[model samples]
Target: MSTKRYCLTCDLKDDEALIAEYKEYHKSVWPEIITSIKEAGIVDMQIYLSGNRMFMIMECDETFDPVKKAEMDANNPKVQEWEQLMWKYQQGLPWAKPGEKWIEMEKVFQL
Candidate 1:
């Protein structure tokens, strides 16, 4: 099986305490969220933090469709809850649309 990779970027609230809290929450992500992610066809995912900046690496099979996942998440109460909770720490890039989050990064170099 082959997989595709995507990188996304977002910014945190830039408060030390809030950043610590955010990392703690990631230490044990809820089971429901894990299941939802797998169901979305994501093969592997990881997030990294640098100061107030955040980057996510998502690897998925051809079955993954981000648009479809967004639709599914919209109807899932657990997802809604998770998103609302994360909003306390996450912020969209300045160039992002009003309601957009996790702006996709362009792959300028690959080898």
Candidate 2:
């Protein structure tokens, strides 16, 4: 299967306590959510942070479709619960679409 990489950006609440809590939550992601991620065709994912900004890199098989994955997550009660908790520390980028949480970043250069 073909593999694709996606880059996404989001903003975290600038509060230190919130950021700390966010990191703590990620230290042990829910098992159910982890299963959902694999089922969605995502093989690898990483998040990096600077100041209040966050960047996520994801590698997935050709079967992965962000829209489809999001739809599936929406229907999953556990994923929805996790997302609701995460919203406490997340903010959409200023230029993101109304309902968007993470904005896909355009790749400029690659070697």
Candidate 3:
């Protein structure tokens, strides 16, 4: 079976202390967040950071559906709480829709 890959980008507040706190929180993410991701059909996910910018890579199975995932997240209190907590460190991209956190990246090249 083939896996679908998605790349997204977001930014964190430019303050150093806040960035550090953000990293620390990630070191031990809440269990509910992990479960939610797995249930959403994300096989693997990774985040990379540079200064205040962040890049995320997600590999998902065929069952993954962004709209369905969003609906699921909205209904899960733990997920909502986690998202709210994350917003403290996250900032939407300039062109992102209102309330959008991670902006999906366009694929321009592949080998």
Candidate 4:
């Protein structure tokens, strides 16, 4: 079993509205997003949120490449649409550039 780890973060400006929207979208994430993840060899994924901060953890197989996954996402029309829609309820870190929503975190510890 591959034990790779990756992380991503986004913000929730308006707590109630953001939470509701997040929950609703997660109830059925876009099919293309799921397909893209699986295609990239992502084996397991989880997301956690506290107040306005969101974190995503992912485990990927040998074939996984974050850069490639990002390229795929950029090229997929459905994924683009989904991302655009999602941005309406999400915010990026202060350091993130204008069009960027999720920012990767460096892993500092593992046990």
lDDT of each: 0.93, 0.94, 0.96, 0.86
lDDT of 2 by residue, 1-111 (tens): 779999999999999999999999999999999999999999999999999999999999998998899899999999999999999999989898876788889999999
Q: Can you give the TM-score per candidate against the true fold?
A: 0.97, 0.96, 0.97, 0.89
Per residue, candidate 3 scores C-alpha lDDT tens digits across 13-92 of: 99999999999999999999999999999999999999999999999999999999999999999999999999999999
lDDT of 1 at 36: 93
Clashing pairs in 2: none
Q: Considering every candidate listed, which one attains the maximal lDDT?
A: 3
What lDDT score is found at residue 46 in candidate 3? 100
Candidate 4 regions exceeding 4 Å error are none
Two-way TM-score contest, 1 vs 4, winner: 1
Residue 39 of candidate 1: its Cα lDDT? 96
Q: Against the true structure, candidate 4 has what lDDT? A: 0.86
lDDT of 4 by residue, 1-111 (tens): 756888988786767976788878998998888998899889988889888788999889999988898899899999889988888788778899988888888878889
Clashing pairs in 1: none
User: Which residue ranges in model 1 land beyond 4 Å of their true spot?
Assistant: none
